[model samples]
Target chain A: GIQVEQSPPDLILQEGANSTLRCNFSDSVNNLQWFHQNPWGQLINLFYIPSGTKQNGRLSATTVATERYSLLYISSSQTTDSGVYFCAALEGSNYKLTFGKGTLLTVNP
Target chain B: SAVISQKPSRDICQRGTSLTIQCQVDSQVTMMFWYRQQPGQSLTLIATANQGSEATYESGFVIDKFPISRPNLTFSTLTVSNMSPEDSSIYLCSVRTGRGNTIYFGEGSWLTVV
Candidate 1:
């Protein structure tokens, strides 16, 4: 079983701020995903980056598989982004995800 | 994108009772997963359900506590047996599909045991 660790258990920022959340894995992974859990309990898939970099609007993610680490970047954060950000990693071919503790982000308007 | 719908978005159960949560997907998928998230905690994988096969449970999770049935490709059910106050949490249904084997989750079934 692989372990996923997310940094900065909590974060707060103004509406126009930028932030970076990091996820470190204890072992190699075949799939990595970032998710956003809104206040209403909807888990939204933010990115599916197993390697390389991907950008979606103001949110971007980079996974360095060789280094066993991934980074999620949010630019000009908004109040809508106030929620829990989770990073889950899947190892081997089991298709099971090991999730991190999550980073709680609060963007003040 | 996969559309996942879960029944009984929220519920309250009594100790020693059981409740079954239903998960339905818009498209047929081979691999479906059940996850649990305790209050203010991260998600934990409970089991992996595949059509026509017994689900594979993760460590610390057993079939007796969380039984899963995947009768077909588009539907599955998870039953929490002998519920207790400690069992209060959010149970989510997820599926992996399309390119990159991306996973998508439903709105989750929030359960509170009293």
Candidate 2:
């Protein structure tokens, strides 16, 4: 089983601000995903980056699998971005994902 | 990508009772996973449900307490047996889909035992 640690347990930002969230894993992973749990509790998949970088609109994520760390960047954040961001990783051939505690972001207008 | 639909979005149950949450995926998948999110806590894997075989429960989770069924490739069910206050949590169903093997989750079933 792999252990995931997400940093900046809590964050507050004004609209239009930029921020970065990080996730550190204890072991090598075959799959790494970033998810946003909105206020209504719907878990939205933001990225499936096991390695390299990807961007979707204002959200982008980079996973350095070799380093066992991933970074999520939010650009020009908006109030709608307020929620808990979680990073989950799957080690080896395991089908289950180990999740981090998450980074709770509050983007205030 | 797979679209997951979970039944009974939220429920309130009395202690000693049991509830079953159904997960339906629009596309076929090889493996389905059940996870629990306790109040203010991160998601934890309960078990891995594979079609045609018994589920593999994770440490701290038992088959008797959280029995799972994967009757087919597109559907699965998870039952919370002998419910108690501590058993109350958000139960989510997920699967890996597409070429990326990206995982997708259902909206989740929120349960509260009193």
TM-score of chain A, cand. 1: 0.99
Deviation (Å) of A83 in candidate 1: 0.4
TM-score of 1: 0.97
Point out where model 2 deviates above 4 Å: none
TM-score of chain A of each: 0.99, 0.98
* Candidate 1 off by > 4 Å: none
Q: Each candidate's TM vs. the true structure?
A: 0.97, 0.97
Error of 1 at A69 (Å): 1.0
Query: For candidate 2, what is the lDDT?
Result: 0.93
* DockQ, cand. 1: 0.87
Q: Candidate 1 residues B17-70, lDDT tens each?
A: 999999999998868999999999999989999789899998899999999999
